[model samples]
Target: MKLYVNNNLLLDNITIAESLKIRLVGLLNKKSLNENEGLLLKNCSLIHCFFMKFTIEAVYLSKDMKVLYKETVKPWRIGKLVKNCTHVLELPEGMTTGIGIGDNIILEGEKNGKGQ
Candidate 1:
């Protein structure tokens, strides 16, 4: 799957971490994420980068795909919890440039092909 912001391709090869275990281990122990890859955590608002080796841009999204908050979280740091956020997108630093608060996001499925 891929993530698009205002019809602009944002992240490809998206890994949806909907399960508890998957969400718990999000981006942990990973060496790095490709420039076009990211992880989407369902039912998540806050994130910790305790075991991550790199920084990431975290985008908090409401259930309706509204961008509620965004921040560049460094390794060993904790992201802020945005009220009413039902999902969280974790991407490589600078990947979220130009995306701002209140921007509507779209989660494109594989049917559209990768990175579309």
Candidate 2:
């Protein structure tokens, strides 16, 4: 799937990591993330880069798809806890420049034509 912000294709390739195993492993052991690729961790509020090799941009979103918080996390760092966040979008650093707090994020191929 893809992630779109404000009707613009932000991440062309998106992987939804909803399962416990997938979410636990996350991007760990991965060498790098493509410019247009990202991972969405469903039912997550915090993340840790303990075993990651590279930095990443983390965007916290509410259940309604509103961006609640965003931050750039370096390797071996920990992300802040976001209240009421239902999922977390992990992307390459600087890819979230245009996205901001309270922005609505849309996921392609959804029945509602928007993220849930």
Candidate 3:
């Protein structure tokens, strides 16, 4: 899959199966994450899991790759749909610097008809 932030390509042809094995420390030090220090995206879910903590940031996205809604949730927190979200992207703390509401995130992957 490919990840684009504000139309800027970040990761091209990234296979989540392999990327999933990335540890927290390496993810935190990754530079090309477009302000997002860490990412845990699979299929359509973006989960930023803090192994040392109890918090996770979840952002649901639409089919067109727009952020439908976002939530900073803990383990006990429940998730709800604020919009028609088909995907989700999670980021580490303080990683959403230049991003905001209505921002469009373009994702090209096998699931979205863009085969790798």
TM-score of each: 0.90, 0.91, 0.51
RMSD of each: 4.1, 4.3, 6.8
Task: Write one digit per residue (lDDT tens) for candidate 3, span 35-103.
Answer: 423343434444443333444455677776676677765543455655566655655444455456677
What C-alpha lDDT values do all the predictions have?
Answer: 0.85, 0.87, 0.51
Model 2, 37: alpha-carbon shift in Å? 0.4
- Report the C-alpha lDDT of model 2 over 1-116, residue by residue, as the tens digit: 87899788887788888667778888995999999888888888889999899999999999988999999999999999999999999999989999989999999853211222
TM-score quality measure for candidate 1: 0.90
Query: Clashes in model 1: which pairs?
Result: none
Order of the predicted models by lDDT, top scorer first: 2, 1, 3
Residue pairs in steric clash, candidate 2? none
Candidate 1 lDDT over 2-45, as tens digits, reads 78998888777888887677777788858998998889888787
Cα error of candidate 2 at position 11, Å = 1.1
Whichever of 2 and 3 has more TM-score, that candidate is 2
Clashes of 3: 1
